[model samples]
Target chain A: MNKDSISKMITIHGVNGISLLNSENEALLSNIKDQQISEAFVFLSSVMPDLEALLAMGAVKQVMLKGAGQQNLSTFAHKKNTLCIQSDPLLSATLLGQQIRSAIG
Target chain B: MKSILTNTISLKDDEDSYLFHEGECLEFSSTKEQADQLSEVALFFDQFFSALRDSDLLYTESHIEVDHALIIANILKNGHILLTITNTAPHAHSNLQHKRPIIQTPRSLVSNKTPSKPLDKKPTALSESAQLAIKKILINYLGPASTIIFNDVYSKWGALEQPTEKSRANLLKLLAEELYTQDEKIKFQAKAEVILKKY
Candidate 1:
């Protein structure tokens, strides 16, 4: 997707920030300024492979984390990269995932 | 020593659900085929979360959706984690279907071949329609995530006892407790009572 569409995806309602990270855990494009949040997501994505192996079930489609006093953090695999979104806790992760998939597709 | 809270939550008949505290398995039930994977995943999560906590970012809850399952982890009041795994793969449905033949067997043969139990002794099971009705009531209060929350709690409720009137009432009470405010719980309880009357 182009930069404009990527920018539009982050502007979705309830979204606080968004980041697109490559396999190296380097942010390729992002709107989130908090390096801590970005690193947290990147670290989470890094564990997906180990989690999947431990599960022996299938690939990790998405992971959502909610801190006590912070915005909800969600990460999902999209094509070759990972998309991390920080949003309001009330936002439906499943619906957000669907929208992301459709937007990228 | 910390007292573990395991009395309220019950694993379903299929035993696919589990509850873990700290790094220990407090409650777990699953088929033989899934036991290994579940245990492995549990250990991995314990280590992973510990590592995450050391990083100075504390998350109280996590939800992981895999291609074949949904894993949910929550930190309880006692500083223990409640990890629940639900199999959502298509093949899991096939395993569920295997149980259908037992229920679909000829009733006449079953009645004739086995000693009949007293009607009052048998617990009533919830019909599909009743479950759907309850779900609708929940959706009004909890919105889209209501479905996932319902399924998780409903499985536990079903495992507690046969879905009789009393059990159904308890299910509503437990679900109502999920609401944040006392007023919402009261309103939810009232709305749920209407469904109970119909069921």
Candidate 2:
């Protein structure tokens, strides 16, 4: 609706496809990779407790298992969709999660 | 002759300081490392007990002779647990380690009723049409926007993944009931229940 609706490049992934919503609520970038991954997140999110528990246990903040060079996978959920955010590493993941939540709202 | 396959197991209470393990083995208190591992095991059993308490769950006293070991259980009390892993001794009668009953009958070992077939068939999940019916019910209960959420749930719980084909009907009913009860108002649960009975 407005420029502030999605200031950053936002992609709302559903079970079917990924919708990259622009500032005007338009899908300027979109595709569907694997539907199974999103469905798995939905199932797991229903049965899990807050991620804060892991955080409180002093779990690793950002766990990145590097493959050869650039291939990285963030291991574990969400109706559930995953935001494949090309996030700024310097920025807080928590803050990014908050932003994503607000955008969904 | 006590088969060398048989050994002793012990359970111990480590909830407090200086508690000894009591079972069929020599009594000894746990070291700090042992105590830590035991604590986690206690939590594990607690979760299992909680899950089984209300269900039609039952167990009989028996040992699992896996490989070369005979497992045994200990009494659980006052946040204490004990497990004894007994290893079958070498040069013992290997047949003594395990025994399985075998009954040979002509046609019907069971009652004269028709024999049930083995459960070797692939699971029969909800047909796409059946899934759509449930989706339609959900849409009516909530809103169209819920398709996204339902689709997500569908991805997670594809009806075809059920191990037993017979339970597919009941599973769909359970899923519908869960969705309704989880979000419906307390006053509306009865109505929702009535609606879900159609499934």
Candidate 3:
């Protein structure tokens, strides 16, 4: 995705920031620079492959983490990269996942 | 707790489901036809919880939507992670399918009984009555797994030939650490202190 589309996504209500990280966990394109979020994404990326193989389910498409407050992080698999969306608590993670899937298609 | 799981199913209006804690199946209905699916999802959740715990994050809940179902994991009051799955039609909209589940089997089927050990070998410093009382209090905070965890901690605490006040306090500290938050730990310690005083 281009910078324009990525910028548009952040403007959506409840969306705070967006980042795209490659397999190596290096940010290919990221608007947010929080180290904790980056570290979480990297950890997720490292374990997701093994988790998929052990679970015997198809590749995991999306994961959403909700903190005790209004902080939420949702991750989606996009081609060879991972799209990490930081959003306010009101955003429906499932709906966000679906929207990203449709956009990528 | 069966009631908690039942309440969740009612609230979600969903299909057959099970609850898991640390990769172990804590409870499930007998009519479950999705054992394989549930097991795979549970294993995935075990790893997910571990990742979050290791990160020292403040996450209270998590969601993973894969294949045709949504798996939701919540951190329980006892600092344990519990996961439940809700089935949905493939490619369906965000609205979840609300099929009423079959009647759940009695929890007795799954067995919560702790294996009995020889009384002679057990620790006597902690009286039997006190042990039972402490276990009862734990049930409120730790739920069904209280018996197992209580028995485990009791073994160590009982090993002392003449338990000092400091050692007794240490035992309570260990149990309190199992609670989810500082507030919970404080509350549990207060209640536990009341019972231990008589012993």
Best candidate according to lDDT:
1
Cα misplacement distance, residue A6 of candidate 1 (Å): 1.2
lDDT of 3 by residue, A15-87 (tens): 8888888875578877777877766666555445544554444677888888777468888877788888888
Ranking by TM-score: 3, 1, 2
User: Docking quality tier of candidate 3?
Assistant: acceptable
Give a tens-digit lDDT track for model 3, residues B1-199.
4355676555345544566554344556434334424444454554455445555656767777778767677767654445666656653434434345544533444466332221222355555445555655665666434545665676666664356654677778878877788987898888878888976
Per-residue CA lDDT of model 1 for B84-197, tens digit only, reads 666676667657644321111122233544322112112345543345456556655664335446666777887876667666788888888888899988988898788778
Across B34-87, the per-residue lDDT of candidate 2 in tens digits comes to 333333223323332222222212211112223343333233444233444333
Best by DockQ: 3
Candidate 1 yields a Cα-based lDDT of: 0.64
TM-score of each: 0.58, 0.23, 0.60
Model 2 C-alpha lDDT per residue in residues A1-105, reported as the tens digit of each score: 224534433442312233333322223444534443233223222212212121122221221111122122221122222333333334333354455556645
TM-score of chain B of each: 0.37, 0.29, 0.40
Stretches off by above 4 angstroms in model 3 are B8-14, B30-44, B90-99, B102-107, B110-199
Identify the superior model by DockQ, candidate 2 or candidate 3.
3
lDDT of 1 at B174: 80
| Model 2 stretches astray by more than 4 angstroms | A1-105, B1-31, B58-65, B75-79, B89-180, B183-199
Which pairs clash in the backbone of model 3?
A: none
**TM-score of candidate 1 to 2 decimals:** 0.58
Error of 1 at B12 (Å): 7.2
Clashes of 2: 2
Q: Residue B105 of model 2: what lDDT?
A: 22
* Candidate 3 whole-model C-alpha lDDT, 0 to 1: 0.63
